[model samples]
Target: MKLISTSNYEKLSQQAGEEIISRIKRNPTLNLGLATGSTPTGLYQELIKDHKQHKTSYKEINTFNLDEYIGISKKDRNSYHYFMCEHLFEHIDIPLDQTHIPDGTAKDLDEECSRYEQFINEHGGIDLQILGIGQNGHIGFNEPGTPFDSRTHIIDLAESTRKANSRFFESLDDVPKQAITMGIASIMDSKEIFLLVSGASKAKALATLMNGDVREDFPASALKNHGNVTIFADKDATALL
Candidate 1:
């Protein structure tokens, strides 16, 4: 694991953007694993700027998102699908056909999970994965205590997670209580991983990730077992480290 701490969020986003753009230049058909939420919004904006300014082509890039709320439709504003389209996908040249996100409204969610897992395997796994750690140390929607060996599966959102996400909804009750997320093992399969951390809200979690034992109680600790993990963080997030 490698840690690169920047002075602030903008610098962090710019540096991370450079790394991603370089990778895309090297392999236009790169299979990218993406994450949603505010932590990555800046990075997405930077990518958009690059696309407009330098014409960084994403026409052949294949993107797979990390997770989605179980009860929401793709059109729902809060859905990860909508989030991607708003934040990154629609702005880039990547084809909608090549962008993959788990179907949260599938009648047979178990089958959907299987299909998602198989789809990733068929594409030769993720070449690069971008991740953001939750305040409770969760990755994707894999809350605390999720087995590190787990795969793509359904998860009951932890109370802390739901509360954290409530800001996006009108109220806490409006938040989805369940989600489908790629598991730790699924994430570990990526050839390279970039873990982005920002703001003081994540300071303690980042501290735990750096100092705590490799236990399932703190999900991000699982990254310690991966060989090619690089952490891009801002001073606020790394304050306690």
Candidate 2:
């Protein structure tokens, strides 16, 4: 595991974006695992800027999002599908058909999870996976207590997770109670992982991750077992370190 800290969130985003751009330049056909939420918004913005200024093309790139809220349609503003389109996909040159996100409204969610796992394998696994640690140390909605060996599956969003996401919804009650997320095992399959942590709210979680305790109780800690994991955190997020 490698840690890189910056003075503020903007610099952290720039550093993370530059790393992603470098990887893309090395392999234009890179399979990227993406994350949603406020933490990654800045990073996505930086990527968009690079796309506009440097013409860093994603035309040959393949992207797979980390998770999506259950019961939400792709058109729903709150859906991860819409989030990705608004934040990254629509702005990039990548073909829409090559960008994959779990169908949160699939009639048979179990089959969907299985298919998503298979789809990822068919693509030769993700080359790089982007992640954001939750205040409670959850990664890609794989909340605390989630088995480290689990695969792509549905999860009941933790109360704290839902409450934190409430800001994006009209009201707390409007937040989805469940989601389909790439399991810890699925995430670990990535050749490399980039974890972006920002804000003082995540300081405790960042501290816990850096402590090197590989316990399932703290899902993010599972990354310690991965050979190539880089953390780009802002000073506020690493203050407790």
Candidate 3:
């Protein structure tokens, strides 16, 4: 695991975005795994700026998002689908068909999970996976206690997660209680992983990830077992380190 600490959020985003752009330049057809939430918003914005200024094209890139809220339609403003379109996809040159996100509203969710796993495999696995660690150390909604060997599947969102996400909704009741997320095993399959963490709110989690033991109780710790994992964290997020 490699760690890169930035002075602030903007530097963190720039550092992460530069690495991604570098990779995309080296491999235009890269299969990129994406994560959502506030942590990655800045990085996405930086990518948008690069697309406009440097013409770094994503036209041949294949993107697979990390998760989506269950029962939400793609058109829902709160959906990851909508979030990606608004934040990055619509602004870039990536073909809409090249981007893939799990269908959280699929009638046969179990089959959808299997299909998602199969799709990743058929694409030769993700060349690089982007991740954002939750305050509780959850990764891609794979909350604490989730088995490290699990696959893409539906999960009951943790209460703390729901509470944290409430800011995006009018009320806690409006936040979806369930989601479909790529499991720890699925994430570990990536050839390389980039974890972006920012803010004082995540300091404790970042400390734990850096100093604590690798255990299923903290899902993000699974990355320790991966051969190539880089962490781009802002000073506030690494203060506890």
Q: What is the per-residue lDDT of model 3 for residues 108-218, given as tens digits with 9 covering 90 to 100? A: 999999999999999999999999999899999999999999999999999999999999898999999999999999999999999999999999999999999999999
Q: Candidate 1 regions off by >4 Å? A: none
What is the C-alpha lDDT profile of model 2 across 1-241, one tens digit per residue? Answer: 9999999999999999999999999999999999999999999999999999999999999999999999999999999999999999999899999999999999999999999999999999999999999989999999999999999999999999999999999999999999999999999999999999999999999999998699999999999999999999999998999
lDDT of 2: 0.96
Could you tell me the TM-score of candidate 3? 0.99
Worst 10 residues of 3 by lDDT: 165-174
Q: What is the C-alpha local distance difference test score of each model?
A: 0.96, 0.96, 0.96
After superposition, the stretches of candidate 3 with alpha carbons farther than 4 Å from their true spots are: none
Candidate 2: misplaced stretches above 4 Å? none
Q: Could you tally the backbone clashes for each prediction? A: 0, 0, 0
Model 1 TM-score is: 0.99
